[model samples]
Target: MKNYKLRRLSDQPILKTSDVKPSVDGFEVLGAFNPAACLVGDEVILLLRVAEAPRGKEGFILVPLIEEQNGTPELAIKEFNEPAAPYDPRVVTLNGKVYLTSLSHLRIARSRDGIQFTIDENPFLFPARMDESFGIEDARITFLEGKYWITYTAVSEHGPGVGLAITTDFKTVERIGMILPPPNKDVALFPQRINDKYMLLHRPMVSDIGKPSIWLAESEDGVHWGNHRFLFGGRGLADNPFAWEGAKIGAGPEPILTDEGWLLCYHGADPTHSYSLALALLDKNDPAKVLDRSDAPMLTPELLWEREGFFPNVVFSNGWIQWPDGRIWVYYGAADSGVGVAELVRE
Candidate 1:
């Protein structure tokens, strides 16, 4: 087995503890910034998942909204504590009063140095209808042809699904609507066309029939997709319980094509529910065929911030930028609170 080492690119949280704490309206838990980098003029832009909740309380499920408090836009939390409601682990129960957590929308933040980021004054995206009332999360950006392609998680009462939007400039987005329907998310589009067809990674949740596993889909026009097939599932000496992901594992960023194969960084959660970052290499021509995969994580919750926060023992990445000099800059959410970056040598 070949050993791969990942190094911290930035010593501190790149997007937290600001001298000026920018108002994210009703957002509280912010994470899963995808593509992590885009070229805008001479600068690189990042679109972050800003999870919002109301003030002074917590629960499992509720809708988030931007409410003005003391002339400042703050994330408002609402609790849904109905006994008939679905099960959620994040909420607490007390005195037959079921309290739910509120989640609302996504915000944008940009950086010049790819370290220090400035939150936009306004939201980049939000859930405007009943279908997406639960908000959006974990966006993946793929710049292809002449447009930036974005695939994100659209949560609602129906279930979690994947949504698509495109942008020529990061400021304005043209929503392509829900590309993949219910119980499916974590969609990542390849950076370029494969054999002149678009390729994507998606997870279709089959609760009763099967476990959540990574699947491959192809599209000729990048909108309409077909040819769905299982790419990989939870399997190894390390894999136990033999159930969908043991916890969960999915595509990280757009695969980096190298002479060896397609280098893929993925996130895997153990039975303990602790999240870690792992690596895999797939055949270049047939990406669905797995060539090799790391049994353990290449990056885990080793840092103080990563080990402790809103959720501990989590280091998740959706975006990584490869420099011409061969350094890979990976921007990831740490402990579900803020964003962090790391560097790995491309061997």
Candidate 2:
């Protein structure tokens, strides 16, 4: 980790909580983080996850929910006391039904240096489909065959599903609708196809019996996916506190294609929700076959930006960029409050 000079960019957080209410979603934006990074022409594009909550009575935690009423999706609010709400700040559950505490949308931010950014005033992608009634969260962007493809988390009453959008020029976007059924998120697509097939890394949240593990799926045309198989499992206890990734694990930025194999950086957490990142390699030809896995974390929550925020002890991302000289730039959302960048130099 020493050779990889991981410094917090001076511009620190390139995006933040917005006061503006979503045009048609929620009351006001609370936080923005977990950006999806990639390059477009000379500009570094960031699709930020902007989280918003309804402005309801302060004492009663208002859980905003959506229901398909009269053939149309409608927003509904459920008031609850602090103790009755779900233990997780991000979600609420009642009678075995789960709902999001906040609604999320994707806003655009761009920069040339990747440190200094210019964020768009309004969100570009919000809850448009019934599947995304709760809102859209973390997104993964891949530049495939001359177009930028976006696979993002579409959260709602049923569960979290994966949705697709494509754009040739950032100005126009084509929505492809929900691709994954439900109970899934944390998706990444390889920039180049494997064996002439579009390969994907995705995480599907499980019930009591399962751990948040990584899985692989293949598609012929970058849309339809099948032939699901297990890829990697999350860590838990180890001799050192920094070694365990037990809480849950998910795919981070899209995998980097290196001469060795497909280099994937993924996040793992402890039971306390302390998030850290690790590395893995997948066979270039058959991504389902894991070539190597990290015994220790490449990066963890150490700095204040990473250790504190709305969601403390978190450093999560959906994107990263590698330069020609083998220098890697990983931009992540710290504590779900703001954004930060880390640099990695290949030894």
Identify the candidate with maximal TM-score. 2
Query: On residues 63-181, what C-alpha lDDT tens digit does candidate 2 reach at each position?
Result: 76566778877766677766553387776565576778887889888898888788887778877678898888899999989999999999877788999999987778999998898
Q: Which residue pairs show backbone clashes in model 2?
A: 235-245, 235-246, 236-246
Query: Against the correct fold, how does model 1 do in TM-score?
Result: 0.83
Candidate 1 lDDT tens digits, 190-217:
8777777899989898876766778999
lDDT of 2 at 80: 72
Worst 10 residues of 1 by lDDT: 17-26
Worst 10 residues of 2 by lDDT: 1-10
| Count of steric clashes across candidates, in order | 15, 3
Prediction 2 TM-score vs. true = 0.89
TM-score of each: 0.83, 0.89
Q: lDDT (CA) for every model shown?
A: 0.70, 0.81
Show model 1 residue runs off by greater than 4 Å: 1-3, 17-35, 57-62, 65-100, 236-245
